[model samples]
Target chain A: MSSELLFAVVGALIFTLGVAGTVLVANLLRRILAFNLMGSGAFLVLVGLAQRGGESDPVPHAMVLTGIVVAVAATALALALLRKQHEMKDSEEELTEIDDG
Target chain B: MSATLAFDLLLSTALVWSAWRTITANRLDQAVVMFIVFGLLMTLAWCRLRAPDIALAEAAIGAGLTGALLLDALGALRKGKTARRRQ
Candidate 1:
C-alpha cells in the first residue's frame, strides 16, 4: 500500500479510539486528552487523503497548520476552565466543612 | 516491501501505539508523555507524506507547545483530582 493510504487508515483507527475514549472515559483530564487525540487523527486523515491522489497538496497542509494552532488554543481554554472548576469545588467543600462545624 | 514502505509501516505502528498508550495510561503524567511521543511520530509522518511545512509546524506546535500545555495542566489538576483518585 502507498504511504498515503497507510497513514490514512492509521488515522481512522486513531480517530475511532479517541471517540471511544472521549465518550467512555470518566476523568475530565482524560476526556481532554482524548479530544486532542481525536483532533490529531482528523488532521492526519485530512493530509493523508489529500496526498493520496499522488500529489503533495499544499491546501490541506495549510489547513492542518491552522488546525493545530486552534487545537492548542482550545486545549488551553479547556484546561483553564478545568482549573477554575477545581478551585470552585475546593471552595465549596471548605464552605460545607465550615457550615458543618 | 521497499525500505520506504517498511519505514512508513513502522512509523504508523508507533503512532497508534503511542496514542493507545496515552489513553490507557494509569497516570495522567504518563498519558501526557505518550501523547508527546505520538505528536513527534506524527511530525515524522508529515515529512514522509512530503508536507515539510506541516512537518515543521507539527514539531513546534503539535509536539512542543501542546505537550507543554498538557504537562502544565496535568500538574495543576494533579493535586485535586489526583487526591481523589488515590482514594
Candidate 2:
C-alpha cells in the first residue's frame, strides 16, 4: 500500500477510537480528555488528507493549525468551568454540614 | 515499506495508543499525563504529514498550554477533596 493510503487508514482508526472513547467515558475529566483526543484525531485526518493529495497542501495545514489553537483555548476554558463547578459543590457541602450540626 | 512510511506508521500507533490511555485512565492525574503524551504524539504526526505549522501549534497550544491548564484544575480539585459532596 502507498504511504498516503496507510496514513488515511490509520487516521480513520484514530478518529473512530477517539469518538468512541469520548462517548463511553462518564467522568467529566475523562470526557474532556476524550474530547481533546477526538479533536486531535480529526486534525490528523485532515493532515493525512492533505498529504494524500501530494505536494503538501498548505490550505489544510493552515486551517488545522488554526483549529489546534482554538481547540486548546476552548479546552482550557472548559476546564476552568469544571473547576468552578467542583468548588461550588464543595462550598455547598460545607454549608449543609454546618446547618446539620 | 519505505523508511519514511515506517516511521509514520510508528508515530500513528503511538498517537492512537496514547489518546486511548488519556481517556481510559482511571486516575485523573494519569489521564492528564497521557493527554499530554497524546498531544506530543499528535505534533509528531503533524510533522509527518508535512504540516510544520500545525506541528508547532500542537506543541505549543495543544501540549504546553492545555497541559498546564489541566494540571492547574487537577491541583485545585486535590485541594478541595474534603469539600466534595458525598455521592
Candidate 3:
C-alpha cells in the first residue's frame, strides 16, 4: 500500500478509537484527551487523503496547521472548564457535608 | 522494501501503538505522557509526509503545549483530591 493510504487507514483507526474512548471513559480529563485524539486523526486523514495522488499538497498542509492551533486552543479551554467544574463539585460536596453534620 | 518504505512502516506502527497506549494507560500521568509521545510521533509522520511546517507546529504546540496543559490539569486535580481526602 502507498504511504498516503497507509496513513489514512491508521488515521481512521485512531479516530474510531477516539470515539470509543470519548463515549465510554468516565473521566472528564480523559475525555478531553480522547477528543484531541479524534482531532489529530481527522487532521491526518485530511492530509493523507489529499496526498493520495502521489504529490504532496500545500493547501491541506495549511489547513492542518490551522487545525492544530485550533485544537490546542480548544484543549486549553476544555481543561479550564473542567477544572472549574471539579472545584465547583468539591465545594458543593463540602456544603452538603456541612449541612448534614 | 526500500528504506523509505520501511521507515514509514516503522513510523506508522509506532504511531498506532503510542496512540493506543495513550488511550489505555492505567494512570493519568502515564496516559498524558503517552499522548505527548504520540504527538511527537505525529510530528515525525508529518515530516515523512513532506509537511515540515505541520511537523514544527505539531512539535511545539501539539506535543509541548498540550503536554504542559495536561500536566497542569492533572496536578490541580490531584491537589484537589488530596485536599478533599484530608478534610
- CA-lDDT, candidates in order: 0.89, 0.79, 0.92
Assess candidate 2 and give its lDDT: 0.79
What are the per-residue Cα lDDT tens digits for candidate 1 across A11-76? 999999999999988888789989999999998899998889778888999999899899989988
Classify candidate 1 by CAPRI docking class. medium
i-RMSD of all predictions: 1.5, 1.5, 0.8
Candidate number with the higher lDDT (2 or 3): 3
Q: Which candidate wins on TM-score?
A: 3
Q: Could you say which candidate leads in lDDT?
A: 3
Candidate 1 backbone collisions, by pair: none
Please give, for residues B1-87, the per-residue lDDT of candidate 2 as tens digits.
488877877876787778777877778899899989888887777777777888888898888999899998888888788446353
DockQ ranking, high to low: 3, 2, 1
Residues B22-72 of candidate 3: C-alpha lDDT, one tens digit per residue: 888999899899999999999998987889999999999999999999999
Residue-level lDDT tens digits of model 2 in A1-101: 65555666776776787788878888787788887777776776776776775678888788888888889788888888888888898888888988999
Task: Tell me the tens digit of each residue's lDDT in model 1 across B1-87.
Answer: 599999999899999999899899998788889989999999999999898998898899999998888888777776776665553
Residue B82 CA error for candidate 1 (Å)?
8.2
Taking chain A by itself, what TM-score does each prediction score? 0.97, 0.89, 0.95
Off by over 4 Å in 2: B82-87
Weakest 10 consecutive residues of candidate 3 chain B by summed lDDT? B15-24
Name the best candidate (by DockQ).
3
The parts of candidate 3 lying over 4 Å away from their true place are none
